[model samples]
Target chain A: MTPRKTDFPLDQCRCHLETGPIVLVGSQWQTERNLMVMGWHMMLGFTPAHFGCLITAANHSHRLVRESRECTINIPTLELADAVVGVGNSDGDALDKFDAFGLTPASGKIVSAPLVEECYASFECRLVDDSQIDRHELFIWEIVKAHVDTSIDLPRTLHYRGHGRFMVAGDEIDRSADFRVQNL
Target chain B: MTPRKTDFPLDQCRCHLETGPIVLVGSQWQTERNLMVMGWHMMLGFTPAHFGCLITAANHSHRLVRESRECTINIPTLELADAVVGVGNSDGDALDKFDAFGLTPASGKIVSAPLVEECYASFECRLVDDSQIDRHELFIWEIVKAHVDTSIDLPRTLHYRGHGRFMVAGDEIDRSADFRVQNL
Candidate 1:
């Protein structure tokens, strides 16, 4: 099912990403566009909505994103589990992942990379720093735009446990009362 | 209940960490020790068992970790929710987190940091690189030793979603058949 997303706050992107769910990274360079399943990522800052992820030079999408200096971070729910596995197993160099996985690509407002329409949320990111790229294969990004299907409330996002296993995001427990107002 | 953990392979640390659970970072420097609740961490490499996390210098644990160059990454289950919240909300400078939170600290084999005995898994780490610490407040560590409770097939870990809400890890889905053997 395609989610109808609305513009979301860039700073609040951590609410979805910090949970450490497996994400589909979409990238484009000229005529080439590709999707790659990624799990090594983390939130870095709040003001610029900084995010960081490790993308090895071996992946085809790495070249596309590095050259374009742009990429889309999309969160796919449990419903897209099969496609997530398919995208991870196949080589993006030989096939178009969107077409092969039967997923729709929507144009990003701030980046050239296409967003996955079926994803629960998508963030347009521009490479902010390349210093660590060569040494650690890590890309630091500034999230310029975010789109979320707020209607879903809580998404059953997939979290990779490696070895072909995924743990689905489950029930939520709120302890806002226990937190310091400033900390929250 | 305290889990009886056994030595786990260092290279396979990503199996538990890649899923993005909220972890209790334990650190010690001389007589000073602290525990910080962290959600911003990711696995970077396999052979050296490299891991990275963003910890603002303002955090008391950051100072302790930086000074000692060692820390313990502990994965707490849902049962330790109250301690997790209490540890994150309270200041460690004036308070002894281990005593206040009623958690036991065990000596690590490879690091000076004490591991939380209540946690399902604890990884002893030593700072491997300090280049990004000043610029990004990121600490890159090499996990030298790991301990895990293999008795628990799947631990119901917590994933932070900001605003004091946590998403508990749910059911597991295995797609081993679909994955390429090498990828798996």
Candidate 2:
């Protein structure tokens, strides 16, 4: 059986990071021959599915964002939440995240973004629209490829709320097909 | 102790439904109400931040989309995944899901659609933009109010893939303040 991840204590983040998971979006610079990481990100669509990640104009990944435009959304499960969060603090401008974190980069089919093998779910997204994102450095892209490890029995996800806190998504909580308002 | 949700299954309907959740737009007639469950949802902004979900015209929630133009997005935890999916399955045009699925509705802070208490989180969304949706029904709204059960030790989320399969968001795999990646 695949071992369940347990290092991340995300309840602290959920109560703190009220927004969502702290993710890492990375891409390679054609000029630099390296990849950079990002923290500000969110899902865009499912039909022609995509992702929208907010990057500061100065972040190293921001440069790659312009260079590659395509990036990978690496979902850090329990084992990588800490390291994943660390990427938020580590600047790709100064340091290469892949070299510092020991993460392996895999080739993606739909987009130019490199997939992080250590993370369970990797989404390949390309540009779609960002009419309102100039001030915030926001870029929305369509998800071309999404792959998950079916071997892992339990479902897990990580979200970044604000600061140090990280929210952890636990196993299934199947409510009855018949919903009861009284329980609320 | 809160029970672990083992019965809920992951959905593969990401392409068709979008990667967002539904906000309860009010029903048109007393006989039946419309609710738009979106899939192109995201946790984008963080400071004074909110989430964004998409609703397509083809969706049964279209009536809820048209009449009230306001609704609540009750976050369904593992326990409520089945009901969420079921609501996604049964159309409001043909039936009253609130009654058919035994979903209890509560008044919203901003919208008219009832909020399901069974869900772990709830968000009230108001219609903002309709320009982007082409063949799909798109309603862009700001997440006003959000709620979650205080009892859950660890909060997990549901990721929609498409079809009936929904992946449960899991816990943290690792924690890193300064994350770095290396080209493998």
Ten contiguous residues with the weakest lDDT in model 2 chain A: A9-18
> Residue by residue across B1-184, what tens digits does model 2's lDDT show?
2222221111211111122323233344344466544444554444434334545566766655555656666555565555566676666778777777666776655666676655655555565555445533444555555554545644455654333334555543333333334310
TM-score attained by model 2 = 0.68
lDDT of 1 at B134: 94
Candidate 2 local distance difference test against the native: 0.52
List where candidate 1 sits over 4 angstroms from the true fold: none
Candidate 2 lDDT over A1-184, as tens digits, reads 2232222221121111122344567687674424444444444443455556666676667777666767766666667754565565666667767777777777777676677778755666676776635744668776666665545644355544333444555544334334344211
For candidate 1 chain A, which ten residues in a row score worst on lDDT?
A: A1-10
In CAPRI terms, model 1 is classed as: high
Candidate 1, residues A1-184, lDDT tens digits: the string is 6898999998899999999999999999999999999999999999989999999999998899999999999999999999999999999989999999998999999899999999989999999999999999999999999999999978999999889999999999999999999888
**Each model's TM-score?**
0.99, 0.68
Best by lDDT: 1
Cα lDDT tens digits, model 1, B37-117, are 999999999999999999998999988999999999999999999999999999998899999999999999989899999
- What's the true lDDT of residue B42 in model 2? 52
Per-candidate Cα RMSD to the true structure, in Å, reads 0.6, 9.6
